[model samples]
Target: MAFDAVVTDLDGTVVRADGTVSAATLQAAHALSAAGVPLLAATARTPTGVAALTTLAPHLAFAVCCSGAVGWVPGAPEPAWCELLPRAEVADLVAFLTRELPTVALAAYDSRRWRMTATYQAMRPNTHKGPITVVEAAALPEAEACTLVLGHPDRTPEQLVAALIEGGFDPTRLGLHRAGRRFVEVTAAPIDKASGVLRALRVVGADPARTIAFGDMPIDTTMFAVVGRSVAMAGAPPEVLAAATDHTASVEDDGFARALTALL
Candidate 1:
């Protein structure tokens, strides 16, 4: 089947563990570009994070970052748009989550910069890098955020989300989804990867039904629903795999390149 565009998640879908793209993956991306199929990224990463993907950015026509809260052009100075969580809602969500999970750590991304609690700062490994401003926990809700990350040392992101729901944490006007294994990310409601993909497709006049997507996370399910084909990585969780329309090898084996070769 022919596709007009390609949308992929970054971390586990295309990028290797060492944070680099394989030569085969690069060749496939170049092939897509040469064929006029723009490769776009829909990920939970911020603009900085997306920018850090230098090896892949040259092949990307557009990037939907912060789990779809911000849109970016490959080398543009500013984001196309940044959707921020309402400050009041942030306050309410933070208060509720803190009470429910006392050990939880909070971090907020305000499009350009990150405002996080000292506890969260300490929790981050030295390898985890970003533009961060360590602030008091109470100061977190004061700034509107593009994405708010909530993490607990013990619980997995899926478990954290389940606990939040069970504890009656209202998600009204907010998008709450898991990121990686440790954090639950929050963004404005109705602005997810699907929305971001649609926005990017609009720029190039591509149809959602002709766009193929690749991802390996639960948050990516929304993109899967909107795209013509959704290829889940082999290493993805059972639920994520089940949500996809197709499956590919694991990233360790250049799964994205293999899938693109087969699909195109």
Candidate 2:
């Protein structure tokens, strides 16, 4: 392989539409690793949410989860890198979101778990998880949160963003990026899958030029733009398509497998 490593976005990138990584995708990743290329998972999902892959690609070095708020080095019992919401901010933001959009979903991130509110508990079916602990917002501690997630079908993410600003929300510390048409995720400004990958690159001594990224949504745009060569899913959003160097097959079509084979 010309590249030293391969970094990928989860969800609609390497993972199938139903939240499973295809047998071919996992096989290709293992093939990449067997060839001495490191495979990094860069996703908006939390470490716990990404845990299912250990059963598939266990040798992966690190995973960029919760966008970039959490990073777990492979084989480690705990996260090697984690960034959470400031102690002063989490509660206020939660309060605001609760008051304004009572049905909005919220998530917490730390070394051991990715906790979600009762509202998000029901949405777990759409989430890729294992041994999940379901709890209420009242059951959680009053500390920093890595990110606050909100998704609604009747309201576009753009509209929610507008409403957030109108409600005196300061986006300075927040990050909002798309997942799909019906979903948008918000995290701390410092954590994004792209920044996380770059940090991992520095740790591994691999440059962006020697790297290739693949994704299927707007959240993956940052990673795509940073890598020298990026292949977007055929079903990717316009922004992702524009950011990618080329377009590949959709997730259901095994686009990542084809892209990885070409990289070799």
Give the alpha-carbon lDDT of every model.
Answer: 0.86, 0.73
Clashes of each: 0, 2
- Residue-level lDDT tens digits of model 1 in 146-260: 8899899888887887777776665666788888877888888888898989998999788999999999988899999999889999989898999999999999999999998
TM-score of each: 0.95, 0.88
Best by lDDT: 1
Model 2, span 184-249: residue lDDT tens = 666777567788889887777788888988888777888886788988998777878998888889
Residue 206, candidate 2: alpha-carbon lDDT: 80
Clash pairs, model 2 backbone: 44-67, 45-66
> In angstroms, what RMSD does candidate 2 have relative to the true structure?
2.4
Per-candidate RMSD, Å: 1.5, 2.4
Sum up the clashes in candidate 1: 0
Tell me model 2's lDDT, rounded to 2 decimals.
Answer: 0.73
